[model samples]
Target: MLSFLEGHTSEVCACAWSPAGSILASGSGDSMARIWTIADVMSRSSLQNEHSSVVVLKHVKGKTNEKNKDVTTLDWNKFCSAPPASYPSGMGCASCGHVKFKAGSARHGVFRVEGRLLATGSYDGQARIWSTNGKLKSILNKHKGPIFSLKWSKKGDYILTGSVYKTAIVWDVKAEEWKQQFEFHSGPILDVDWRNNVSFATSSSDNMIYVCKFGESHPIKTFSGHQKVVLLFLFSFSSGKKGDMWVSAKHYFVWAKLTVSNGTPTGSLLASCSDDITAKIWSMKQDKYVHDLREHAKEIYTIRWSPTGPGTNNPNKQLLLASASFDTTVKLWDVDQGRLICSLNGHRGPVYSVAFGPNGEYLVSGSLDKSMHIWSLKECKIVKTYPGSGGIFEVCWNKEGNKIAASFADNTVCVLDFRM
Candidate 1:
């Protein structure tokens, strides 16, 4: 369940999975993107000569094999596609390793389009598409600044990306082109989410969340309350006939449902982190504050709900909630009762991201201290701390709940196998 790949000399920033769930795609600050198979990286002791960069010039008539081998004289096609599957694999131009890991000031972030299609945003102001099998699909060169975040819709037919240049765009998967451009915040768009095709929300350094519908040039509603720049915004869904719920964080954290239907949130319940060091839940429909759950002594950086329904023992009890903070701890809470359930500690630095594992029996978290920790719900303690690539900024759990993808501030991404 614990393994480390030291392929990136700098920081590994982003990690993603393929449709088949066998391969992992990672982007690094070394200006290289790599494809690692789960069996290859985990089962084997080493991958010798696997991270080669030699460009192979295949010939049809006569030529030397660039793979340190000599071959019969053959004719070579001067123009062929699919660059050599190198150490780090990501989208970049054919001539220069634009997507390869580089030194200072390079753009880096990775997102999955479909289950297999992967996209990377670079400081080079381009978004590159690739297949999960380590093949470059296309390069998007329309953006003028670093692409900070990228996401695919539920159906995987479209793409949404946020930029440091203060804008977010939606792309058409079929045409491989920009479909819509949304401009609202004056500062860089830090994060964005597409809510089941019904609506989308964006966070910004300008301390705002802009909600917009598809094809609309302007935001339908704007949520402004944070005193500092909003760093992340996430939307969640339930089975009932209601819209999506949104969770947003900045200097504060807030959650709300956009609209309401039949006493349920037709929209979403919105929540936010407060400078007061408490997380507040709000009713978007009622425009009234629900409850201010104050527990953390420091600022709450992140919050997430359990994937499972409310506890079976107390179906009427409020749902379970998890929150991380600068206090160097993560805490679980009963949102309905507004009481602390358990305190999870041991992180040395600020805990940036926390997530419930696939089985809900465990939780995973990433910390600025350069580690990912897997905690046991049964024991309510740190079970293990998986070393990180750089300063872990985010940790993502795939749909299957087997792999954990961690993004670092150093621009590298790491994938941890949870099989153990």
Candidate 2:
């Protein structure tokens, strides 16, 4: 068993690792985010001492009372101290007002591109950037409402920010400002991610996924196949220049991509996860359904292909697809053969977040139970569970896949040293 790492007063919202996997960065609802080094966490006594003065955890009845408590104390030089634009991790109001500046609530979520930087969306209606070493980078204060989600492009050059204010903005990270990338739906943007280069996709409370492209002012392709609001999405890759990929979801629907070669839409494929407790694949080219997978009794929330293994080189790899659901289990499927390989069960609460480790031998999941479970893929059993301060919202492993960083709903961040 490993000793747990702790330091955050409120719900921990976001966490990321430095490129070299030396330092971990986290954002929380306590109105502050922090960066911790590997050495800081490895030595339990050292980590506790350095983080002791950073957070003052008090069980308050109201969520908005965080500012009234000692958790608002910023760690001067040791923590986020940069001004609003400089990307300090501390919770400080950066809004400008003629009467009074509302700092808004603390952060709710965070995401990172690589080692050097990461992005966070806060209830204060802002998105801020930070260095993995715990330095503040920049602050964006344009969203009229709280930012719900933040995603970085694969290139790390740009980021997409979704807000409850009913709009999504693409930011040019290099320019240190907002870019007029595209306007999202009138509803609050729930999730967003880039698709390769030419296009990006966004989901909203309206239960729609808008496919957007560069230069266009509006969504070029509006995909409206899901009955419920889409929560998560990912794009599969193809090495061939002319081939296409697909995307899946919480409700029923898979989106297939078709490229134009001679000014013609060549192919299409689609997949759907329905309330009927079934998942199906579609042929976009034929505009019809192709196959159905009725493996689980509940809704599917997560689906991802194995970047390595059979999904890449071996034709046999194409048969593997990992899916997690409200059923409290994770099912590994042979997509090509359309059958189950294994069903992983351990978590007591809804498995809200899941990710495959770099080695593919371990799988990590965060749950509403306020804990993160690390499982051995080969053993198909829980190896360890790290308790957190609040409802565990997300868990992200550093580059080396040894240390895990987690975000909580109470505005706090927890760093776990697996080796411990």
Candidate 3:
């Protein structure tokens, strides 16, 4: 089954599934974040009568029809489960408590895992926390330039914001204040991700990645090798065992595992990809790269580690890495062997995003060609194809792996039901 969500007046840049997979939130250039209720879609017997409800959470103030207040990025609170329909007021906002940020666009917004608080970073050089129901909780008024990226710790105790000012700040969630600020990057900070509750990593346009921990005055580990700006990175610690870490950075994608012995972090594994047409895997223990994957003909846009393999959700499946690129292809790499598994060649335009299903049996890729493809890992072929009306920016699968959501440049979001 397929459904098109049309409400945003401009491009829909970001969309995230609720932790429970009952709701989907999409951010748009229209300066609005919309919560869509899709619980009934799965039970409906007929596609002809399909209907879902949406709650528009306006990010702008005053004018009902405002412009330039683009909601650039948004993430759902990982710990929250109740949808907007369960809220008493159906997503109403408090007029007085909300802070009216400057007209600059909001670059990133994320929800803490424990509390229902949502943290949003803007070009106005400020970050604001909002309740899931649209009430402003607190305002983080620091940073000297636009915030390019922000992330909430898995424990939900701290929030990290990276800015073009070449600094990254860790904010105390409960205290609603800045705990520590790190001025380590020589260029604008592009992305930030938490490695653990207290330690995290940051990437910068200066072609470097820094790993820092709480209460530390400087970065504990500095990774330098990417020839171009590092766009983004993620730290995945799915395996409860020590010495298992996965990290990725744009232009460079790094998968690293922090080896812990008696509670002390010993070493890590890092993987990075770049516009230089190469992807390299580094070993923190050896302090050098162990594998260099050079197969793509164009600049790689994004890469993701599969949620399967050892220490992951599906331990029976081999660990794989998927990378999308401007060459209009998606390549899967064996993490253990550091070799190409297969190349998915279908899209006509540059592929922008790729995501693995929670079970790791399938992979999905979205491309600027205005299409999305769902491929079976075992068969290594496209099992399903979805044509879109606009260029696709992002694609993601819900936790249940039953629904896939894609954001497009045409100011719309599409959801594909994949129960079969």
TM-scores of the models, in the order given? 0.71, 0.70, 0.83
lDDT: which is higher, 2 or 3? 3
How much is 383 displaced in model 3, in angstroms? 0.4
Ranking of all predicted structures according to lDDT, beginning with the best and ending with the worst: 3, 1, 2
Q: Score each candidate by Cα lDDT.
A: 0.59, 0.55, 0.70
Write one digit per residue (lDDT tens) for candidate 1, span 1-420.
Answer: 444444554455556555545556566555556665555344322223232222111111254223312111110011112233432545553422234333343443322222445566666556666654456666666777777777665545566777878888887766879888888889987676665454667777786777778867788777765666566555533222243344444422223222235544333644455444666554344333355667788877778765543222222323456888999999887544557899998899998888877556788999999999998876899887877547886676765777776767664445566764
User: Judged by TM-score relative to the true structure, which candidate is superior, 1 or 3?
Assistant: 3
Question: 13 in model 2: Cα distance from truth in Å?
Answer: 2.9
Better of 1 and 2 by TM-score: 1
Question: What lDDT score goes with residue 199 in model 1?
Answer: 66
The lDDT, on a scale of 0 to 1, for candidate 3 is 0.70
lDDT (tens digit, per residue) of candidate 2 on 184-203? 67677766665644566666
